[model samples]
Each structure stands twice: as C-alpha cells, then as structure tokens.
Target: MTTKSIPDILRQSLESHMAEADLRDDDELKELLGKLNTLSGKVAAAKAQVMARRSDKKR
Candidate 1:
C-alpha cells in the first residue's frame, strides 16, 4: 500500500474547494477565491517549512 503525505492531501482538498467555488456567481466567487488564495499561501508557506526540515534532516 502507498501512503500520501500531508501536504499532498491538503493540496488535493484545496483544489477541490476551489473547483467547487468556481461554479458560484461573480461576486461570491471573487470573495471565495480571495479567501482560498489567502489559505493557499499560508499552506504553501507551511509546506515549505516542512520540506526545509526534511532536507535539513538529510544533511
């Protein structure tokens, strides 16, 4: 069996959320996209930290 990492799981969930929000009206979609963007940035930052830590461990 194969296991997916936390970051991969989070990325998938974020993509799904964004896809669903895309079907809404313009105003509502804009608001949702803004929030999703903020969340995605934060998640990317956190994922970077995790990757850095993993690299450090390998050194």
Candidate 2:
C-alpha cells in the first residue's frame, strides 16, 4: 500500500469540491491551488529537516 502525503490529500479534496461546485471562479481556484502548493513545499522542507536531524542523532 502506498501512503498519501497530507498535501496530496488536501489537494484532492479541494479539487473534488471544485468539481462539484456550481459557483466556480477561475481566479479563486487558482489562488487556492497556489496556496496549497506553497504549503506542500513547506511541509516537504520540514519533513526533510526532521529526517536530517534524526539521521544526525543516529550517528
């Protein structure tokens, strides 16, 4: 089984909402997606830092 990251799950949920939404606005959707992408990058960076710290402690 494959694990899905938090951001991926959130993005999927947001896209699903957009698909089912009647009041679709292009600019709003784009902005939301941009924010999600930024958050995803931050999460990735944090995870990497945590992993690096763990590796250092193991040495």
Candidate 3:
C-alpha cells in the first residue's frame, strides 16, 4: 500500500486552528515546526502561565 502526502489546504486549516501557526509551503512548515519544537517547553510554560493568570482572575 502507498501512503499519500498531506495536502497544503489541510496544512493551512490545521495551522489556522493552531496557535496562530502558519507556513507558506511544505519547506516552510518543516522549518517552522523545527523552531517550534525547540521552543515547545517555553511555549507550554507560557500557555500555562497565562491560563493560571486567567483562572486566578476568575476566582
């Protein structure tokens, strides 16, 4: 069986639904993901901090 590659439209949709994530092409997507991967921990930490602040303000 052969596997099909992901389409650009699907990638665009996914990125739009993500954290304002976007890319111009497959190569750009690859590069963007690589950079994001390296900053994943920081991203998660920042998200958690923002969430915590929101929760604290709500209560």
**Which candidate leads in lDDT?**
2
Cα misplacement distance, residue 34 of candidate 3 (Å): 7.3
Which ranges in model 2 have alpha carbons more than 4 Å from their true place?
1-3, 19-25
Tens digits of per-residue lDDT, candidate 3, 1-59, equal: 43322343444455775645443446767676656555654656676798899999999
How accurate locally is residue 38 in candidate 2, as Cα lDDT from 0 to 100? Answer: 90
TM-scores, one per candidate: 0.54, 0.74, 0.39
Give Cα-based local distance difference scores for all models: 0.67, 0.82, 0.59
Ranking by lDDT: 2, 1, 3
Note the residue pairs that clash in candidate 1: none
Pitting candidate 2 against candidate 3, the one with the higher TM-score is: 2
lDDT of 2 by residue, 2-31 (tens): 466688788888888878894375898888
TM-score of 2: 0.74
Best by TM-score: 2
